[model samples]
Target: MSSAADSNSDGRRNRGMLKSYYTQGENSGDKQFDLDDSSFKPDQYLDFLLKKSSLNELMHQEEEIVQNIRSLDSEMQTLVYENYNKFITATETIRKMKSDFGQMEEEMKALSENMDNICDLSSSVSDTLQQKRSGIRKLAGVHTLLQKLQFLFELPARLKKCIEMEAYNQAVRYYTRARAVLNQYQHMPTFAGISQDCGSIIYELGNALKEKLRDSEASSKQLAEYVDLLLQLEEPADSLCDEYLISARSRVDEKVQELEDVLEDNSVDILEFVDIGCNGVLSNVSLLVVAYNDMFLNRAKANTELDSIALQKVSALVKEILHKFFELIQKRVQLEKQTGDNAILVRALDRFHRRLQAMNKLLPTAELATLATEIVYNAAKDRIDHYYQALTDHLGHCITDIRQALAAPKLISSNLDENSSTPLQNLVQTSVSSLVEQIKAVLANLQAFIATDITFAMKSTFRRPFCFDGVREGLVVRFLRRMLEYLNELCEKPSGPATLLLLLSKLATILEESTIGYLLVLVDEQFLIVQEGDVQFTNPQTLKDEAKAAAKKLLNNYVRLEGQTLSHMVRKSVETRDWLNTIEPRNVRAVMKRVVEDTSSIDSQVGQLYDDMEEQKKDRGSDSTKRSASGLMKSSKTWSFTPSTTAAVLDNSAFMTNISKLFSDKIDIFSEVDASRASIMTGIIKIVLKTLLECVRLRTFSKYGLQQVQVDTHYLQMYLWRFVQDENLVHRLLDEIVSSSLHRCIEPSLMENSVIELICERG
Candidate 1:
């Protein structure tokens, strides 16, 4: 049993062992497979571990990145905030500046308003001055009327007194009263009445005296008859009565002797008294006659021991008085001729009128018209009737003498003709010549009178509205126009030596009155209209026509005068430039600016005249053919081509050279007048620059042979290369040309660079 049991145990052990071996093998296989799988699982585990670690790291990194991003965002936000703050500060500054500018604009507006107010104030002051002037004018008109009344009522009685007695005292009292009235009128607001009253009273008194003298003569004659009758009727007288009569006669004789002695001591010569009396009536006439007589006597006694200066003074006084006298007499004569009543007076007046008409024909219409107006104004009423009557009586006596001479058998028409030239012609010539001479002589006196009257009027209580320039210019223009007309008439006469000399004298008188020193300057400058050796007019119609034409021609001559004056002024100012420097810069600037503007205006007017001439030529259809014909015939034909030829020939260098030469000669480059220089240089420079620029552009573009393409480096380089080769020479030429041209063109004050740039852009 033990042995069997051992065998079984052995077998069981083997089986167990085998079983354990199989289990182990299964386990090993499982393990191997598991290992293989575990290997992948380890990799997976590692990957999982790595993934987990990576996940942890990624989470950490994500957290870190989020923080970093937040930090970066914060920094970016800070930067943006700072930038925004800066922008706001800049914007605030800009806004403040804008507000300040707005305030400045408001201030400027207020300043403008103040300027406007100042202008309004100035205007108000001007208006007030004008109103004051107007008020003064009304006062003068009323003063003239009072003078006329005094002349008519006072002077005749004093003149008619035969002796210095009670009548003379009464007349003197009346005259004194009239003079007091005149003085009172002069002191009043307006002296309107003084002139009229004085004139009328004197005239009326003169007439009244003549009537009084006649009445006195008649009374004396009647008294003489009565005294004779009384003497014849005388009866036998008592002794005592005779003794009384003798005593009375002795007393009367003694009184008469005393009176005679007194009269002899006090009395003047009869002729001297007569002269004094006449002088009182006609003040200017008597004085003038006396002066003339003195002058004549002085000349007759030229070799006497009298002072030459005194003689000259007498002659001057005579001339001055005669001028006044002639003016007064002419006025009176003209007045008388306008109105008359008697047939003889009427006939005399008619003859005088005819003579004036003939004179009017001889003189210029303008002068004649003025004279006629003056005559009409002086003779509007019957005041001149007495003078006309006197003239009629004298003329009637002359007519009677003429009639008797004609009726005489020895008298002949030929003799009459020999004695006098054709009465109408002779009278016209004489009267017209006399009038012209009188006008010349009176000019200085009239000027003095006008100046004195104007000064007095301005200061007087009865002041008239006056403008210094307006009144002076108006009077001067009127006087000059009248003078011009007279000169025209004189110029129409035949060029006789005497007539020529007379004309020169008259012209000299006009020069003295009008231009003074300026006329001599004009003559020196050869600015007068009269040329050397011009023919004088003879026939009346020819004279009239020539005068009219010459009058028109004077416009151009006057322009020359203005030009010369301006030129002289400019030259003088330039010469005295240093002196001008002392003046306020603004004032100098203003004066120079005004001079420039005036010069420009003159140039514009001259240009307008040229344009008008061109228009006239066009209207006449004479320019083209005449210009062409002249060009063809003239030596200057090559250069004096028409516009068409000019355009065609402009391409020719030689032609351009010739043209430039011609232009240079005709245009004064260095003219002191800015306008002249500006016009010429501007035109030439513009043409030359335009032509050169066009030529340059054309040549450059043609060389490229490119169209419709933007300029590129290659093309630019090619052009640049070619341009550079000639650049130095071209640049030098252009610099010289442009500099010289612009120097001539622009004002001296302008910058060269700026001018050049402007020319390049605009030329």
Candidate 2:
């Protein structure tokens, strides 16, 4: 029993210890029982169990938990501090890199500024150097001009002495040398201020030298000396003075009077001096007076001695000077001929020609007219002849050059091959073409001038009818016909584009007035010939009858040609892309109207002639009819007047039927053409609309006075409704009419009526 008690107590003690251990670990019974529950709330159980533990023990345990928490917090703080240091280091490095980039950008900007400064300085230096070089060049040119002027300054004195000594050759040589120096100086690139003064001095010196020589010729006692002086002065004076200088007439007259006094006294032993001086003075005075009568008052004396010995001397001198001038001209012409580049020579020739023309202009009024006409005629004839000669010469030269080029051995193969497409060949072709065009142009101009002049001349000279007598109408008609024929020929020529169109335009102008009449006559004639047979003259009448017949024939031909020509034009217009829209229908209508008028006129004339014939028959009375009937009976066996019963004649001879047929054919052609010209059909329709509207307007106006407020609105509406059925056309027509009415500011009622009428007519 004792042993059983001991075992039970041990078991009880073990259970208590186990229970205590579990209870210390878990405060709640549920927690103590849940040993397998890993998600149990230990903190909540520990707090509950701490309230039951010893204070010292609990305090120690609490200290240990607090220490653990503090250690974890310190570790976390160290890690955070290390991460912050890394972030700070990265930010510092980024700032340092940015600083470096900023420094580099500033350095680059400074370097760029330095480069710009350097370039600017270089450009400034270059500009300065160029300016200096230009200055140096200008200085050099000034020095050269000064040197030339120095050389020219010594010329006048030498020329004066030569003239006094009558050494013409020496005078000319000096003058030429001075002129050459002056020319060289003029061309030098010096300061204009310096050159202008020098040029004036040189011109004055040249003029003075020439004047001295001219004076020596006019007053010198030695004949040989005088002639030499005059010859020396002639060319230079003429060249320098041209027509600008007024000759020293007072000095010349004084010298002449002194010589005459000496001749009368017979005390002067120098007979040659008196004779030569007197003659020279008189001749020069005469020439001067003739050239400048406004300056000289010695015309009466001049004219008195004009046929005397003094005049003969003057004439001889004049002839001599002219000969020299012509010789110089011939020499220049020869030089030009040799050089081929003759621009300078041509200019010189033109200058002289202009001087002659000016001289001709200065003649007396009545004499001037005759002189001018003669001169113009002669000059024009000469120029025309010269042009022909020049053309011949140039052609000959070209042929020679071509032959030479062809014969050259080196050019044999190449020439033959390239000649087929050579520039020379092209140039020749171009020249020929150009020449042909120029000839046509000239001929056309001549034709116009001649047409105008001849018309005027005929009117003036043939006022009394010289050749045609009373047949002036025939003469004028023939002239017009010839002119038309000439124009037609010109139009036929294949001139180049510009010239051909110009020629056509010119021809149109030249024939404008005559053409209207001619066209009318032509249309009439063509219609007549095509409708009726050729005109048949049964009996010859007077000259008037012949003239009338001829005029009728001409009219017929003109009308026929006009119709044919118009037909061609119409066809061409239709074939064009934008035909009727581009063409002015008014023009076509005008031409058609002309043709119609012409035909109607001819018909009226024929009717008049028929009436005249009937009148003549009546004048002859019943006897004449009886004779006519008897004669008809006698010739009945031979001429049975049995007109072929083929077509029904509307009139006695079917003339009206034929005329209708001809017009019908033309209208048919026009309609076909219009049908083909689709693009222009709209334009044609518009024109038709306009015409119908106009007709309606005219009819309305004629029927109703201007003040009539009441218009036939229903009639207009009906017409518009019938004419304008297409919706698009109706809208277009309405818009056009409205816009036109707005522009014209027409009364709304009137415009509305017109539009309605147009629309109805169109429908």
Candidate 3:
């Protein structure tokens, strides 16, 4: 009570001290600090602060003041830390500006001197040329007249020389200038002959220009130059433009056909194919677009422009040619549907994407350039989808293979030692290595894909989720979901005991031991790492927990299947017999030997298989095995899946029902899987014996048949002791079978206990 009173009193003192440091302002609930309180006409603000407050309160106020000072100091330091680089940059900029001002002053003085020198030189030159200007002007006219006469006399010969030199551009310039003068005086004999000769040579130059335009080997610049010359010659571009466009179309076609031929060449691998696309087809088509644009769309400054009608025609053709070229680029770069193992095409798609980026940059104004880039980006997405689809199909095939293997009769010629290898072990390891190899190849390809830098302008527009956080998480999720789907297909029908358990062991071991670690390496080293320093791509431990749970569920499923198979065997043995008519029990029936022999096989397969089923529990931080599972596999080095709740991973209810029918007890089947193999085996053995007892109670046994039942029960009891350490469950089950047999016996006779033990031992 005193502490609470002291705390309240301290709070009041602190508030009084705070208000004392500054004048009292208006209350917040009223008009706030708007009241004129700056005049220091305050009343009892400090009446209790200095005169009545204790030394402890004063000391407390001083500590808070010191703390505020420290806080302010910390804030000042934070400001400096945040803006230190900017402060240093500002200092350097100021220094540089000062130095630049000094240089500017000197440059201004030099500029002023140069201007004065230019004024003086201009004055002297003007004085020097003043007297001779009239005479020089008069001679310029005479000089022009004489030069024209000389050019007319030499025009035909010069035109001939130009034709031999293939200087059509120069020839056209010369002939067009001369034609005006020749026509002015064509009535005179000399002028008319010059005009006639020039016309014929000009005709030949026109023909050369047309031929040059058609030449597919002509460079873009050469084509533009030829088109310009023809335009200046007043050649009607309507038909000529059509021909030119056709020639451009033919060149693009040739490049596309060449690419097609390369595609048809099976000997050329994907990398080579991508190379041809970038260098040969991609470059050629872009060049054709550029050349066509230059010739038809670009207006030359000095040459006569094409008429509006002709330009519209040419523009339409240009659009057609450009659209076709882009279409070709789009169709060619699109990757085909391939299996997941073939995701190396991602690298090839990246190469094409880069080339398309160059194309867009080369012709940034063309709508086609941007469209082509977008198309290629979508193609990349489609390729990734196809790769995943292929992987799904590949996994489906693997599941099918397991189904076929399970359908065959299971045989184990020998017992499996934990340290020794078996076909099942080898097969599981090989499958894991095969999958990891596919993932490694995919990682390699996608690494190259992400390494490709898109242009800043395209980056926002073309950004894909391919590299967000790490692609590993999404990929792993999809992969695990599909695999779970395949596993569920087996669960839909009742498969044999070995089938699901073998698959569960193989898959769970690979997932926890090999796959999860590979994913970590893939994200950390090979793929994009998130900068936030969080393992959001996937948390290793949480995923491990989930995997552990899933493996437990599979174990329960296998456990239930084991019980069903054993019970089935018992039912078959009991149902096939004619218990009412039989000979004296000869050396315990073959059914008991079959039962024990089958049980021994179970011991060997399950003991080894469950050791495998107990997968991933062992910190196999030691990944033991690697093998190649495909002809396409390069080597053993690279290798490269479920769920929560009851979706598919846990088959709790149905399994529980089947188990309840067998055991007649409310056993938590799921809880039992965590115990030793002996407990589980004992539970299943007791279930099978109980089934035998149930079969005995249904029948009326003859005295010999009763003896047969006694022998088989004793035989099962003695031999099965090797499997179950706890004989209590086995004893209860076997004893019940004898009592039921005695009750069902028509003669009501019984074999001696020692007689029964000796008969079972003799077998």
Candidate 4:
């Protein structure tokens, strides 16, 4: 009603605007004519008094009339053009109605004349029959009675034929027509026998119909006819209605099951699959309710008292069948996790609801159409929500599956590519590639659905376009947080070996340099959510930058990781020696050679990883190396960078005393390194070398042990010289290692730099 009123008001307002435009020339209210006023009175426009106005004014009025006539014609044409289709339909309807009415009039007149003639004939016949009325009535009664008796005698045979031919309707009509006559003449044995035979045939027919209804495979149309036949047999309305509803519900159930079990095989087109379920359920169930209505509800509607329990049962089953079908739809939505044309899917659901609504023409009170629509719509809405959640879950699942794969034991080293020399190399290869592959797969999958934003129109205000952007942001945060946390964990307690820690650090770098930027490209292209002056969420560009910082942090962790492993090797070498009875140091000890070689390898791996970050850096450590191949000179220059957290984990008293003795006076040692890979790695070497000095201080050494320490320091200083920015820093750290060993040695003879350099060089 409100909508109707609104439309009427809009029409009136439009009409008034057209009226105002039409009357703009006629400014005077008294002379104004309504646009809809079709009558034109020339007398009103004509000035009868010849001297009332000047000739020029009369000529001007004539021009105005001509202009008004042209304006009216234009307006008429425009209105007709707009309403052309309506005008054509109205003309066609008028013509059709005239033709039909005229034809009906002629037929009515002809029938009237025929009725008059028939009346005359009937009166004449009645006059003639009045004298012989008794004779005619007696003869007619005898003929009718004989006809009924003949039909009764033939009733049994006709019913048998009907059963054989499956013409149950014809048989019922034949039996009903003879029932009263048979009952009236039942005293005669012959009539009684005929009635008995007809009754037996009908009993068999009723059994046959009930059996058909019980058959689960019976088609919908067959079920309808079967119920109809039983109802004609005067089957109890309560039982019959109950049976019909049960059978209909079963048929609906089968279709629902078929949709769940078969249609979702995923080979069919989605729209076709949805349509199959809709048509199958709708057409079959329409037959259910329609046939039920005809047999039972129609009678109840006609004011006949039916069992209320039957009515309620019918209502409950209808609701049940609908709910079951809707549950199937819900399951399908949930199971269809793959993102597709959501518009088509949602529209298909709506089409299904519309088809269900067609059943309202048969059963209006159930409102299953409206109910089903809500269920299917919510399913679609929830499916979208799940799409966003699936992205987050996908990231998490990737991490989890990777962890499980790493946890699985890999004893067969040969299975790793032929290039892999050992199990650790294989671990590095698989771990790094798996993480990269997982992230790449996630981004690729994200690309599929994030751009195709599905619209949700039911809201009163605008909704954000499918907040997959938020999901993308979550992927960034989760990948960073989870990956960094795992990296930190590995650095702290490397699960396999130190190689695993380096691999994780490499993975973190990939995230910072490549993967995070990829994610941001996808996120930034969507809605301009962060207005210039408004508050913002975690902006993707900012996140892209932060990932770089995280990469550096992981590198520092890598430093601590290698430092621990190398420091352990130093301790084991010192612990295994018999310093009291040891022979003279020949060249450098194997442990020192291995440590020097591994340090060079570490430098190359870490430097190459971040080489591009600083293209042509001046090697400050190389300057110190050029000063003397002998070793780093003890300098009073303050230590330029703070040691990593590895240093903080140990007590400073022994380590502090070692540092104080190595320098002439204690130099300030706490300084921060830049978060570049080179700076970070230089800090790692300084800390690890200092750790080596601390390990030396922990042991007691004889003369050869002290010489071995000096040889190791010279070789390390020579090779590690080219790796760090502040060359003096590495010199000071290796010098401190020798100084600390001398302090602990029982016999303090040290190898000269010339001798140590020649032995390291020649070997």
List model 4 lDDT by residue over 562-649, tens digit each: 7667777877887777766777766767876777667665654444334432432443322333445442433311222133532332
The residue ranges of model 2 lying beyond 4 angstroms of the native Cα positions read 1-223, 226-307, 316-346, 353-377, 380-763
Query: Candidate 1: misplaced stretches above 4 Å?
Result: 1-482, 485-538, 544-549, 565-596, 603-763
Q: Rate the local accuracy (lDDT) of all candidates.
A: 0.35, 0.37, 0.62, 0.62
Worst 10 residues of 1 by lDDT: 702-711
Shift in Å, residue 589, candidate 2: 38
Output the number of the TM-score-best candidate. Answer: 3
Q: Residue by residue across 1-763, what tens digits does model 2's lDDT show?
A: 3444454456556766676677676665575334234345767768765877788988897798799779756665665666667778999999999999999999999999999999999999889898588888899999997886665555555555664575655666666555544555566654343445444444544455455535534432332232333334332323322221223334454655565565555453332432444245534544442543322222343334333433343334434443433343343333333332323432333334444434333323223233323332332233333433444454345434534553444322222321133333333344344433443332232222113223221232322222122112222233334334433443344222211222222223323423334433442342221222453322212322333333333323332333344344433322332311222111122322332343333222222211133343344354531111122112112322223521222122235334534654222211211111121222233333343333333222211121121122222222222221122342333333222322222221222333433432343
Candidate 1 clashes: the total is 27
- Per-prediction TM-score to the true structure, in the order listed: 0.18, 0.18, 0.54, 0.52
Q: Quote the lDDT for 666 in model 1.
A: 43
lDDT, residue 561, model 1: 41
In terms of lDDT, the poorest run of 10 residues in model 3 is 628-637
Higher-lDDT candidate of 2 and 3: 3
Clashes of 3: 5
lDDT of 1 at 425: 28
